[model samples]
Target chain A: MKHITDFTIVRREQLGQHYFALTLRHPGTLPSIAAGQFVEVEVMGTREVMLRRPISIHDVNPAENTLTLLIQVVGKGTRQLATLQEGDTLNLIYPLGHGFSVEGRNPLLVGGGAGIAPLLYLAKCYKAKGVETTILLGGRTKELIPVREAFEPYGKLLISTEDGSLGEKGMVTQHSLFSAAYDHICTCGPTPMMKAVGRYAVEKGVDCEVSLENMMACGIGACLCCVTDTDEGHKCVCKEGPVFDALKLKKWMGIE
Target chain B: MAKLETKIHNITLKNPVMTASGTFGYGEEFADFIDLTRLGGIIVKGTTGERRQGNAYPRMAETPSGMLNAVGLQNVGVENFCKQVYPRIKVIDTNILVNVSGSSIEEYCSVAEQINELPNIPGIELNISCPNVKKGGMGFGTNPEMAAQVVSEVRKVYGKTLIVKLTPNVTSIVDIAKAVEQAGADSVSLINTMLGMAIDVERQRPYLSTITGGLSGPCVKPVAVRMVWQVAHAVQIPVVGLGGISCANDALEFLMAGAKAIEVGTANFVDPTVTVKIVEGLQDYCQRHKIDDINDIIGII
Candidate 1:
């Protein structure tokens, strides 16, 4: 079941120039949140911003009853969220959309820019299951890949930056790990990068899932504004999935 | 408790708060956040004769106090609705109505006729005012005669309460409202989203794939209120007002302007529980004002 709750900001950390990881604790017991699910955060008391910002679930601590949101300031809603301080009240509708299926024996997790947010939680799930995981994170520069150290304990972490400011200077797809044999692949990032990963997965005959950050209105399925065309038809990214099998997405596999 | 009941033609609402079409989906989307039985009505997404894939992606854009959308009336057509949607939604306790849209007069009547057969559905909101579709939506609504013609045709096959939704993009909204009322509509709902567009200056391109879409939200409230007041006096039928209604104060503005009931539209996106909150607010308003029945305030202005 989904919930609309007023949570208090327990911690706020500025990881980079524009990235902030906010830890919010619900007053009540937190619902079970999956690895790839997200939340619609209400930007309280903002005059200009009308819609809530959808951010991926970066990490969750059930014992603390807290959820961590990894937000990048790209627009007014997110920029407003950056001003939030610890102890401030924030409202959220959470545990939304279908998350990634934790079923891979040896999984290759790929992330680009802000797309790296959800993978940390996914890697933790894979770690708990004793699944061998390899994560490749990419960004335009080193500053873009902010939370590299957080994923170190959960998996083998690899990094690539276009400016050669970090490990293995190149796009994530160019990383040496791409050539490795993996039973399953999951990625979230820029569309072009995910599509390239999807194409590679198809060629390798490996099951893959990509989380799409489509523009949305209501984080619920009511608005039908955030639909992505698929082999089945148009599916609401907020409802049916923000994470989908690479094969079902027409655009991802280069299908008509 | 203040009497919150209101009537539109033969259909009596438990309250005067109905979820607007398109914004409410099939009513199940909001069930997790709100009690489905507390609403006055649930107007499902636009239903047509056949499945419409709708327009291409990039169908929505956010503006200052509002948003623009060209969802193009995407739905599972009437056949699929009866088979797949109806059984699931029939369990929802409140009044369930379908916003019927089409690209042709025959298509409109066909969908309406099918919905009329459903035992649980008490009414159909004939959508001649939708500005998103290219063919039959706003085309029928902008012109008074076309609006009347479509309503009159749908009224023949649909026996239940018929509410014709109106468009505000026209020169005179009252003209279209009066025409629909004259053509056998039991009630008239105004106004659908206004025709509008936006450009992403950074990208130097149109924000929406359709280039133009329906504008809705708090910014459109004044225009909607003005239109509702104008049409409420011009026609004898009850007026169901909607367009940027987010709170009870906003709902009261419409009721005082002569709307018998109000539909909460874009506000649902900002707050999923807004409809029920508005319902509670209405009751609170009635108690605070010492008003016995909510109907006593209709058309007071």
Candidate 2:
């Protein structure tokens, strides 16, 4: 079911120069939200960006009736959304799209750039289940990196920056962690980076799932935009996934 | 409640508010969000004789007060709609019309014939205006002779209400509407998305993978109203107006411009409950105006 609710921005924390975290508080009972799922936040302040921005669920605190979103300045919509101040009412379609799967498999979470928002929640869920987890965070530079304070307690956090500014210097795939073994790998980032990660997993004979960030209007399956061609067929990234098994996807270095 | 009944060809709808094609994917997807029974009708996605994978990703982009889409008729074949989709939507307890598309006359007639056999499906809206497909979509819609040919051929086998959806990407939309009406279309729906393209200035690339996609939203509403008004005057058949309709006021604009009914298109993405909301709003409008019937407001301007 779709929940259209009004929320007030209670806290806004600028993580770095480009990234910020928004904490929105609602009055009613919170809808069931899972890791890897996202919410379609309506850009109410402007009519130019009429369609809602699909932001991944960064975190949710039930007792406080609050939801968190970690957003990076990407375009007009994200920039406009970032301007929302504390106490501003916002409308959102909550808990949309299918989330991640952790059944019968250990997970190594990988996130790069704006795709890193959903990983914090996934790490929390895995930590609660006593599943040993590790996260490989990638970005272009240390200044562009998302804040790691929330994700630190959940798992092992490893960071890589292309400019050699922080953590291990280089793209995520060049990090030393890829040499390790794993039962499953879940990643979300730019298509190229995820494809690299997917290719690595496929080569290592590991189960892999990648969350796609396709342009979308309706967060629901109504709009066929956000469709990603996979082995099964053309599937809506907003519905069947923002998350899919790497093998089910085509075009990841000849998986097609 | 004021009488919200509306008629398209021989079939009477519960109201004048229906969900537009391609926007309202088979009724089940919105079941949790909107009560399907409250809608006047539902026009599901475009169905062809063969399954189409549609276009490449970045199929859509947000423009000024609107969005552009190039989802090139991604649908399961007509047979799949019968075996899989029909069973799910048949029980929705509302009018369900199949939006049919094709690459050739034979494909159009064959797909319409298959839908004609389905007891639950009351009609097939011939989608000759789709702009995303490289061939056959706008190719047929832009020419009056070709539009007539496709309509006449589909009319032969599809023994049900035939509503031909017309394209706005043409020199004269009324000419095509007249041609389809002359070719025996039961009704005509105006103003499919206008062909448009947007560029990502930072990337120096087309925003949509198709490069050119159909533009829909509040930005196109005035053009839709103008074409709908023109087509309504030119053709004797009922006109189902749609373009950038988002709310009841927008729907009313189409109705006042001479549309017998209105279809909420891109608005479904904004609010899933918009159609039902428009229905209730229509009722409210009628009550406020002291009009007993919704039909009294159509073409009233």
The best candidate by TM-score is 1
Clashing pairs in 2: none
Per-residue lDDT tens digits for candidate 1, residues B230-276, read: 99999999999998999999999999999999999999988899999
In candidate 1, position B268 carries an lDDT of 91
- Model 1 chain B scores worst on lDDT over the 10 consecutive residues at B129-138
Q: Candidate 2 on A63-180: residue-level lDDT in tens?
A: 8989899999988999999899998998888788888887434678989998888888888888778886788889999887776666789878899999999999999999998654
Provide the TM-score of chain B versus the true chain B for each model in turn. Answer: 0.99, 0.99
Stretches of model 2 off by over 4 angstroms after superposition: A104-106
For each candidate, give its TM-score against the true structure.
0.99, 0.97
Error of 2 at B182 (Å): 1.1
